[model samples]
Target chain A: MAKQFKSLHPTKFYRDYLNHDIRPDGRLISKFRPVIINIGSIATADGSALVRIGKTTVICGIKAELCPPKSERPNEGFLICNVDLPPLCSSKFRPGPPSDLAQITTRFLADLILNSACIDLKDLCIVKEKLVWCLYADIICLDHDGCIIDACLLVLLTALKTVRLPGVEYDAAIDKKTINEDEQKSLSIYNTPVSTTYAMFEDKVITDPTAEEEEISSGLLTIVVKNKELCSIHKPGGSPLSEEKLYDCISETINHADLLITLINTAVAEQND
Target chain B: MEGKQRSNVKFVFLKCGVVSQAKGSAYFEVDNTKLIVSVYDPREIPKKTDYSSKGELFCIFKYAPFSCPNRRAHQPDADEKQHSAIVKRALESAVCRHEFPNFQVDVYILVLENDGSALSGAITAAGIALAQAGIPMYDTITAATLAIQGTTKLLDPTLEEETLCTVATHKSDTEIDYDSHGIIVLAMLSTHEQISEFYQLGNLDLETLNESVNILMNAAKDIVPLVEKCLVDYVTKTLKSNAES
Candidate 1:
């Protein structure tokens, strides 16, 4: 009943807006909602950032802990990204193991951050095969307004930038690692990757689609770009796009990536100040 | 210990209807501790039962992975379950369960940051959210936590203050014996002037316990006005929008 009602009213309403080259929220076909970010708000975590894309709010907190590196990749550290869409964020979610959307977003984000090589895991190693930093990036969505992937990616990367690890002194004799809080160093950022999500309904496209827009759109395109390089493109296969249209999406991502990078830099600078 | 008066500090910054999707929602902050609660619409109970007259109140209390000093697991742990049970108990009686028999009103709370008194904060936020959701309630419920240290009681204690309560184990150690510490969390229906639920941790004598309860009740009362204002603001906004529409 709810699905039928959604399709009947909101879907048609969205298509009507797209017919005129505008979105339901009154944005241009390639326009995005304002992005706001606050870094280092979570004091308990080593690094943290809270980001909002339109009404979607996500808080990403990174905790750095020392552990033994994997035997095969003894020199590399570990990075894990978990996206939590708790019931508090929306009525659709429940209290239990993560839903499919949560898991998929988590995996997609983990893959994006890793494949993009935003942070070199090798730099996190303290002692070869002995001690390394395990960075856990947990992103919790407070509101599920729409375009969660973009919000999650933005917050996670911003949180990563704010991460600082204290100096660790390894005692081989006892094999005990002593952390020096006075000496701290920020993680080396290899690349800054920003993602943009577009919702295509029939032949028209809406940028940074809101929750309502996403539900009715026939296809979804999420593109991750880093330093003018295409890092990743994810589509779950709803509606097929022509090669030219796909290129248009990629170019749109490139355009938005520059703005996102500047937004992140401003947020980080404001945090340091 | 820091020469700060308990009553001087205005704790528990609160705002209601923060989550747009939830039927009703609230966000609360006290010091670094922050909690967000959303009350979803009543839905049919998934499990079949043999003729139940009253509806159910489902509560889930989650601590975000980075909410505390330690990294919490992705899944809800034993402590979270315990808090959920307490919250469910505190709210079940206050809600008019007969309104929606065979259904459940889901209250989900997430602690974004935890410095201390998270359970009490959750209870308070959940109550306000439920009220804003238009659920029928006997009265608005509010909760307050007090950490008893010796003869002094600290209201709205932080995580450190909550643990400052060290129980005296030996009688011969008079200094430590006098230092008997514990925590009392009370959820009350201020209009009815009755406590819906109470949770105590550690040990306390009857006299000290009574004194602590009084302090907690007063603290809970102080938060009532703030909750009322939030609800009033929500009602006014909703009424104006309804009128315009």
Candidate 2:
């Protein structure tokens, strides 16, 4: 049933459904597909989270290592986020360097997580300038259905929150840092940022567009909200949104942001228990 | 390491079609080492190519950063690149390349954990994945690793055992022994009883190397039943679904 509809002139089929305020998947315009989260599945990583938003699946693994602090930010730790879109995820991507879409998503995530100060870098500092923890977060897309950025942000936040850095024994004079594998401390998470993306087809707006819908939509808007405050708004190279449409999208984002935060917290709590 | 009571081989668990997105995939787990291999259907080679009758195989081997004791890089390191090439070579002989000329089959292997004998596991997993994808092959390929320490040879060595076997020994003026210690990895096509690829990491005498190959061939043969069962189960499931439809 689903396959047959997908092959039928997808754009026109989607537009026809939008005319009646219905999605091909039968979800209301404001409703999102069901989400399932699996946390701490990868025992090798310090922190890991695998999330499936509808059919789009993402896995995030966080590794912590000791590194010399940067000259400019001697007292703070480092955070690096990389997004990999390999051919295994979808046929559309090839096996090589990060594609343009992957690069954009990586930078956007860096902006959302680092610039927004979701985690305090100073908290990651082991010993002032002598030694610091460098957290590398690698987000991989296993299956590409749609709304990859939204799934990636969710998994990254969840993975970062779950990170537990092992204690360390250091001698400054000898410049030796010994990691204590037994005792561990969790990273200090300042806030949780949730992103909601929408696709605009003509004047109609759809939330959490699938791969098919995204291809037909004319404009795209992503809103990031943390603790009831706006963090960032991304709308690059699509149809310009009028003031009213933009306001509506922002309000809709706010409504869904709260839902997403609760969903994430519940998932994290379940994993901890 | 002489009096150690470690088993030559550990129990392995194999399953096929684990990765839902890939055309064909398999997950192989032996002790602490775990690998997931995915195979994509044949597709046209992107760049213009000269006339060639045989199809191409593209293989990528990667280790997740957390898979090893030390964090690995996102990009494939030199060792990983070499392993990728080795895997491609191991499987190329088994696959019937003339079936899909001017096309390439992609095989991607991701090592989720590394205990020891990862290459053998990857080679074995790739073969099963290709078969699960319905790719015609002359025979199934299986691989095994052997670590030699002096006169003692260990089969399916663990990371620790492998390290012990590869350590540099002190040389004495009175007596010197060359090609006595090293690790050997051999891939074999079981039905044909042919050696597809062999990799050695250290020195080994000709006699000892022959003995190790014999041991590795037996171990590789032992794994054939497990792969056969997995592929048979996959085919049964597919046929059952087709019948119902």
Candidate 3:
């Protein structure tokens, strides 16, 4: 019925549907779409993965390089994340540089990953106060059907899980020049944090909105969960959301996070085999 | 005194902030062939032309001094300009220009390494840079250079192959011997199976030309899907990370 009325405003229709505890996509107020994940697809990258949430798609690749540890955190390695949304993904994106939106999203994702302590920085240290592995996680958006933040996090987690460092070889014959690939090890991960996004339109909250739904929504909230613990909360646009609604969203995110973790673990396990 | 010569060439893509001023920048290396491509964005149009129906895209291809084996001149040379024109045409056909009406997308490519098919490398670099910049297009364009030697066609021909192909074809002066006259480089659009751009430096017979196109097109078709998958995978990760954050 909603698809038939192309000209009708989604916000208005969503509001009407919310009164009856339903969504236009035939899901309940808290329901999410099906998700699919694949890992270790890019052989060139140290670690990589591809994830899909309904029609939305994302890919994340991690490259590890040896570098000097930070002066402040000499015993630990560093992690940096970048997000690229090329014009080919959508008509709204233009060719040029990263837009303001992309910058914000990149920073936010980086903060979440760092704060969540998903990776153990100490294990990345090759030499105390000297050398460490600087892991660069580059995430790219190929399609923007909707629910971008959730899709991005899924790919990142899947990539990290599937990645294995090449063996590092210390060549005694060559003045201790180490061959990084010969002595490789897996990254030490403490916990996996999965993310979920919700769009609030006219007091009704929708889970994993599509691009069309996102465009019409007034505000969005992204919740990250690690092992049943809420690790991060991002509510861009500063729209007022009640504590009750926030808790509800978190509960729903935690539930979906379990499903996502299962999907990611299964994909990684398949790759290992 | 006949020894086989083999070239050891490797290419890697690095996310370097060389073009800090630009929105998205990437450094590409194919053995000694190094280049940096930067994407700007849908910025205000500088020209006073009323082509405001959609966004405008501008491409600038330059070769840095000392890029080649020879000591290059200080100013932009004629060959550089010609290469830039070819690259611009190839990109223009691949990108959807009508997406941005009043704004312009600027792609600046600086070649730091000059091996054979620098233009083709620059085109590929530009495509990646554009994707990094987050501009919306229908698909990513992947390009490869071909050298036809009699019945054999080589992909990503090295500098030695470049010279050999030139000599093998150019030395033949007669019109009937034109098929052996030189090599052809084609820039193809992989998705639609269309030839977005083509460049042939040497003379070739019509039959040879048709055969070369077919060979190159088939090779390009094989490569297009790989590039598309790469782009798709990249974007999917970015979105997932965003959601997680």
Candidate 4:
């Protein structure tokens, strides 16, 4: 591991900033950076979206393939989400195997997708037990400035909205194969889930924490919510927080979700138009 | 490429190439692993202290964080540097470096997703990039790695399979079968049917090494034509546009 220099002491500075009701970036604690969402950037994938939250940038590509469903859930389709943090994004990431942080983030995003009630798995099933459409949602962090979770979620949701699955064709003669590009159908989703991450330092909650801020923070909280319901809450931190504070973080995330979803919808609407 | 599992792993080239900025670019996917490569010409070399008669080629290989099941670190590491050197060597062998004296061409490869065989993917990408940049090359180079697990030889093993095989082979006290021992990565120039570079990890015997070379040469033979076709198509398109202009 490379030696790293500590930035400002977030625990002490955050407390001062909170007392003054000012964040390090000169915004209120509840504020977020200016976000821009673009859909259908990758023409090769079934659906794709590019999102930029402040300086953090992410690209999400969703590809749907046919595969055998798991034995327990033979009637439903499968959703797999993977996040890639290339070295170009940051100097800290190595090129080969994934580190612990990458694994945790991938799992967290997968949980968010699974719990969101967004895509109807039954519709993805080609046959009862034999074949199902497996949607692979691959998220690439092109540039990591901060607020990765929120930017990643925005990309995933926008990509999902723009995705159109090729129609599935079934042939009785052969053991069952989903039709090729010419014969496929798009998937219908119920709700879109947006995620917001907050870093709490020195009794102050900072929204869209930057890379430097994340390094010095006491604890980090990621909240994934859909339609006012909490889908996933991932808190990987050393410092403990009071239940009341956690509740405040969740509420703040929910409020952020409302704006994120609107932004996603508008981006999709513009793409369609 | 030389081993029992060589046949199981296959490389396929898809035509009607994508990626517009590259002078010559092609998309090749080895089974589940996919990569796109674009080559830029020998532009004016960066003004620096040293200017060798042999031209320089700048290479950059990137794996999208989600390329593997686990998220990739947000930075480059030693492995990337090592692979970059390997790619440079593989291309240097086939390219006529003296032709572009005082000039440098750049090869940029991006791995969209990686199931296995990322190094080989980069080698193939660099070859395409070189051709795209209109640099004269004797032939295209194709590279592949072969790993042995016990009596079973695995071609292009995934990260999981690689770990399992490495542990299983190194732990046992049984007689070391050089044929099924260690990992061998080979790069071959298809037209000449010659080995450009060979790297081995762990212990291996001469016979196994020979067999591995043969296997990789065969794989290179299969890949060369596809790359040629892509290059021809690209050149034809460029000539047509030039005539029209």
Candidate 5:
């Protein structure tokens, strides 16, 4: 009987559960799924991470290259982020170029890296106006269930935290740089930010919705928190919510930030060990 | 890295149906190199410029940005495009194209790590994925690579070994850099006993090339049993699940 109703009137079915203060997946209104992380799986990459939350999985690989610095920001470096949602991951994605959702998430991730002070750009400079490290962080979705941004954000953070740059020496007289591939150095991370996605189902706002729930939901609200403080909020377009409901989402994300940080730390530490 | 294993293929790990969305998918890992091959169902040809009696096959080969020693761009480069063509040619003869006329099947290979012989790995994985997709095929396909230097033939060489065998080292006085060394990749249908594709790099005498081709054929044939075992396992698992449900 339940399965028949679920397939017939999916929205009405979800509404029935919401009225009973329950979710189809049995998660509470503010409950979040557990995160599983594996670091440095790609041996060729400077850094790599595979993160899974429920059925959604995302892998991030960071490639570091040397390039000439911009004239205006000579000491600053670059963190170019891109997201690929191939047809292998989900049927919604096509085989052509990056879709709008991918482009939007890529830009949103780049913005979070810059605004959250995750890493200082000056640390990547080898010489003033000469050479700087450009990190190409590519995030690929291997599985698409729902709430992909949260998994991608954690993957980006974990991959960046595990990056190790090689020893580099610049010669002013020769105008060339020599890199010692063996002598490795690690990056200094400033702050680690965590993200959580919540969906507005009619009047009820549920956190960490599955792909099915997201389909029935009206809109999505992503909350990014670092050190128990709000770092960024990405609410592209959604139903209007009063101040109290919005604060509820932020507070839930902030409470979960510590758990995410610990997960990342343990995963990275395992690789070192 | 020594003994009889040195001249034979390296240790490999393979899994099927890794990508849930694709009709068929396989992941192949040889030591440090890892790749994923996905095949989609036959669909209408994108442009459809002309009428044809047979179906079309499209292959795309890509190396992840962090997969190689050098940082790769997002777009496909010249080498990757060539590899894409090579892979398509390797799998062309095995498929029964007349079954799905005018439609097109797409195969995508992404190398997560390019330790060595990435092209050969892609070809082998592509064949397995195609079979898993239930595409009509005449026979099972397998591919192997051999690196030749003088009289030495190394099967499935590593990246360092491949470069050393292919790239010509500059001499102090000699003008000719072409040496008796090169790398060869061969794809063959195991049951049909026919070679589908052959790709060679560097310079080698006809005698050496002939000798290496024979060696690669045997190496490629040896892989047939393992691929069959994998496919058998897949069928057994599916049967078991279906029976339970």
Candidate 6:
């Protein structure tokens, strides 16, 4: 009987739970899914992390390669971030090409990482205008659940924290270099930015909505926080909320970000070097 | 040398022999999956101030707007970019880079239709295109793909089979018991039996993966004769046209 009503009137079913100040998953409206983080599992990658928020699982692997720095930015290296949502993750995605959602998430994450100054590009430079390190950070979604942005954000940050840069001996005149992997240095992260996603359907707002809830929602907002400061408020145009409500979401996300940072730092420290 | 500052980048031919910089081009078709590849001449590495002792190869893989069910963007997406990287890696070992120092060769692959095994197909077609362009190569390259669901290994999976290996369908009433399913693509040098690139996705145990590699190699070998025959035909046709002209 409950399944019939849920399949027939999904919005009404969710509304019933929301009115009762609880969610169908036995959590409060402001509650979030449990996050499980694992770091440095992929040995091939310089840094790697797998994060799970509820059923949404995302793995981020960072591979470092050497290339000449761009002429305009000779002192800085490159950071290329790509998110792949393959058919293995879910049936909604196909095998041939990346879906629209995959592209959008990738672009959004790249933008956020840049704006937040999470990792300074200058740190990746090996030699000015001659040789530099290019970090290819690839985030693959293994399972499609709800609130993937939060998981992707956490996993990316965690992966970045685990990165170790190798020492290189450079000959600027000949433009050749030899790597010394024995002398490794960890990355210096500038900021730890974490995000929280909220779905607003009608007037009621729910935090860390599931995939089903996201569909029923008319508006979705993601708030990114760096420490106590709000870094980004990404609302890709859904129902607009009042200023008071937006402030409330930001406050909640700031608190959530603090909690996530502590958890991530502990996980990083626990990982074997 | 006496002229004003000129653009270093060359915009070669538009058509095969016309005003294009590309030296060689080839079109490949396998069932509904069709693609075209063009190889450009070795040129100075553009916008690179540093010197390279050996040449570099850059590949771009893209699909047409209507190639698949959904509309593709003009810019290459993550999958296409990754495909380009794999193709580059597969072809990198085959090419003799010492011949073209401080230069770069650009290979462009455009898939007109996507049936299945597009990446493997792109590798095979790119190899042919490189050869047709008179690029230095160690040996001919070939590739194949395999789809595994449980114990059933489907060689050269169609689009539907590929999807099946990707993820179980939502419409299926019963739960899929056996969790093993995956697709593997292997690119190899058929003459020397050297595998250049191997890519896999899905949840398959190591045992299944080991068996799947053998199956893919066999399938790749089966296609070698066709590729050789196609190249022989291309050479003969060109020779005949030269005689006539």
Best by TM-score: 1
How displaced is residue B195 in candidate 1, in Å? 0.6
In model 1, which residue pairs have backbone atoms overlapping below 3 Å? B115-B159
lDDT of each: 0.87, 0.86, 0.70, 0.72, 0.87, 0.78
Lowest summed-lDDT stretch of 10 residues in model 3 chain B?
B1-10
> Candidate 2, what DockQ?
0.42
lDDT: worst 10-residue window of model 2 chain A: A1-10
User: What's model 3's lDDT at A38?
Assistant: 74
DockQ of each: 0.85, 0.42, 0.07, 0.05, 0.53, 0.02
**Per-model C-alpha RMSD:** 2.5, 3.2, 11.1, 14.1, 3.4, 22.9
lDDT of 2 by residue, B43-116 (tens): 98888559789999999998877777688877779989999999999999999999999899999988877888
The DockQ score of candidate 4 comes to: 0.05
lDDT (Cα, tens digit) per residue for candidate 6, span A8-30? 99989999988998988798988
Error of 1 at A32 (Å): 1.1
Query: How do the residues B1-245 of candidate 4 rate in per-residue lDDT, one tens digit apiece?
Result: 32246444464654423543345556667666777665666677756677789888777677654466554554666776677777777788889989989887766666766766778867876777666766899887777767765455677766555665555343346754433466667888876777887877766666766776676666656766776787788779979989996
Off by over 4 Å in 3: A1-10, A16-20, A169-176, A180-183, B1-48, B51-88, B91-144, B147-152, B156-184, B187-196, B200-245
Candidate 4: where are CA atoms >4 Å away? A1-19, A176-184, B1-60, B63-245
List ranges where model 2 is wrong by over 4 Å: A1-9, A16-31, A240-273, B3-9, B170-174, B236-245
Per-candidate interface C-alpha RMSD? 0.9, 1.9, 12.1, 8.0, 1.7, 18.7
How far off is residue A196 in model 6, in Å? 0.2
**What TM-score did chain B of candidate 6 earn?**
0.85
C-alpha root-mean-square deviation, candidate 3: 11.1
How many clashes show up in model 3?
54
Worst lDDT run of 10 residues, candidate 4 chain A, spans A1-10
